[model samples]
Target: MRQGTLCLLFSLLLLTPRVQAEEAAPSGKTAPFSLSAGSQISELQQQLKESERQRDELSKQLQTASNEHETALLGRLRQENQRLKLQLKEARATATPRLLTDQQQWFVIGGGVTLLAALCGILASGGHRKRRQWLN
Candidate 1:
């Protein structure tokens, strides 16, 4: 009985076409029968081109928005720089130019005082050669 059933099953398998054997899927749907390689490549190329175009458009929109934002910021910065420059110019113009700084004036007064003291000491010593003795 087993030998008879195996023989029958082998005969049925030989009678069916190999291509038609895979026609029906487990889901009961008939898959594509004849898809050429060239058609699949062209379909993929079309999808790629559409995706690239969308990406370019999105990038352009992002760049335009950023440029507008930067333009406004640049204008504000320029205005601030101009205002600061004017303030600096006004400050410089209002300040007085001095012939000498406070430190230099103090040095000049000290030198004059030192010179006056040296002259007074020389005059007070008198022109006596005996008083000019180095040993004393």
Candidate 2:
């Protein structure tokens, strides 16, 4: 009896399909098996290439946009610089030029005062020193 049961199990196993049923069964019905691994891989590769091309296009657009923005900013800065330069030139043209600046004038006045003080000291001292009798 055991030998007969083992033979029956072996025959059952051999006769059954090796492939497992798909997870998404519908109304107690098993889905048909179709193998298209190569086609699916090719489709995924094509999608990857298309995405890469789109990324490259977006990156190029970003670069052009940044370059344009920088150019506009540079032009604006240059115009502002030119305007400031013109203002400076006009100020220099309109202002009065001086032979002696304030600092130089103050220095000259200080020197004159020093000379007058020296002359006054010389006159007040009577221009000579008397010898002391204690030294002899």
Candidate 3:
């Protein structure tokens, strides 16, 4: 009978739940309180979505600025190319006759030197033949 009473008391103690209500309770006396995982996850997901949208907007702005800069640079280069081509054409038209005159002068000088060398060779040979005749 005593053993049966001890066993009944032990089972009652083991089956009883621990008193955690004090730990879970909020300090503020007036307001009811709760902890929820779902609400925190919802808030975090909203913040992530907002950050992703901001990043997308910044990327679009950067791309647009880069395209505008490239277009402006191309326009400047084309204008410079056209200006250089016009200058080159004008220089060629003005300088052609001067270049031809310089070439003609060099040709005339070369021809005069060649003629003088031939004349000198003929006179030397004639003098050599006359000397041979006098000796014979």
Candidate 4:
């Protein structure tokens, strides 16, 4: 609002002098115009100070908001980091364990293989065989 008003004041200040010089306005009108000019100058200075003050306030708020945003992001990242760590721990816990010693593990594996071989042999031997009549 102040900016527009200042622009209009500047335009009028420039144009008014030209108009008065051409028309030769009376001295009474000149005094009022000069008084209004001085008032407008003071008003413009006040508005400038107000604008500077507002700009400073806005800058402070922006700084505060940025700090808060950074803090929030940091907190979320920490939470995610903790969650991932927990997931890793749980996954490791679910992984296969070497509960049995190396020697016991080998023994179990050998026994299983032997048992399977024996089963196969037994099944093969159970099949009927053709006998020669003369040999019988």
Candidate 5:
């Protein structure tokens, strides 16, 4: 029974994944499985390096494209701002000058000036009376 179980296990192992080892040292002897495994590891490392290089290049290209897109947007915004400014300037230039046909503004200014003059005259006359009282 033990021999039968051993045979079954060996067959199972044979059915599993395996690498064919190369011959070593010019003799008919097969190389160790470790040699095959080590070669596979090296190949995997090389592939990983290649994939990383490709990823870096793609990232660089994406960054450059995005930068160009941003620059174009900025340029458009600047042009729009300049156009709006020019429109504003033209509107102001072509604007009609306000004529104060109503006398209300002039009346307000004249009244303020007249009140100021009256206050100054009153203060000047009051100062002279105060000097006379002090002398008395």
Candidate 6:
């Protein structure tokens, strides 16, 4: 038991030096801090703050520009909508029977396509059930 305890202690001491050497080897060199280092840090902090203020001002300007652009776009859209409304009113006042007939024809075609799709779906579902029963 005594020999075992000594061996354990000896192994631990040898391992500690290896671990410490590994840690030191990666660092390569060590630097010591002085009062000027603190001053340099303070200077850097001030410069960072000034840069942040400039960035914030630039951001505000960008936002103002975007807002102006959006307002102009909305104004243009309003004008276009008013113009279209006037044109639509004029067209409605002068619409002919031929135009009305064409509109009705398009509506009937759309309805016919919908009815055909519904019939196809019903037939496909019926076929699927018979196939499933046969497989089972």
Which predicted model would earn the best TM-score? 2
Q: Give each model's clash number.
A: 0, 0, 0, 0, 0, 0
- Candidate 6 per-residue lDDT, tens place, 54-120, comes to 9999999999999999999999999999999999999988986464477899998999999999999
Residue-wise lDDT of candidate 2 within 1-136, one digit each (tens)?
6999999999888766644433445887766545586678788999999999999999999999999999999999999999999999999999999899999999999999999999999999888998878999
| Candidate 3 whole-model C-alpha lDDT, 0 to 1 | 0.84
Which pairs, if any, clash in model 4?
Answer: none
What lDDT would each prediction earn against the true structure?
A: 0.89, 0.90, 0.84, 0.92, 0.88, 0.89
Among residues 3 or more apart in sequence or in different chains, the pairs in candidate 5 whose N, CA or C atoms overlap within 3 Å are none
What TM-score would candidate 2 get against the native? Answer: 0.55
Q: Write the per-residue lDDT of candidate 1 for residues 103-135, one digit (tens) a residue.
A: 999999999999999999888978465644677
Candidate 5 error regions (>4 Å): 1-33, 95-131
55-117 per-residue lDDT for model 4 (tens digits): 999999999999999999999999999999999999999989768999999999999999999
In model 2, pairs of residues that clash are none
Q: Residue 30 in candidate 4 has what lDDT?
A: 57
After superposition of all CA atoms, the RMSD between model 6 and the true structure is 16.5
lDDT of 2 at 52: 100
TM-score of 5: 0.45
Q: What lDDT score is found at residue 87 in candidate 5?
A: 100
Model 2 ranges with Cα > 4 A deviation: 1-40, 101-110, 123-136
Tens-place lDDT per residue, model 5, 11-106, is 978866543444337666756678789999999999999999999999999999999999999999999999999999999999997766458779
Candidate 4, TM-score vs. the true structure? 0.45
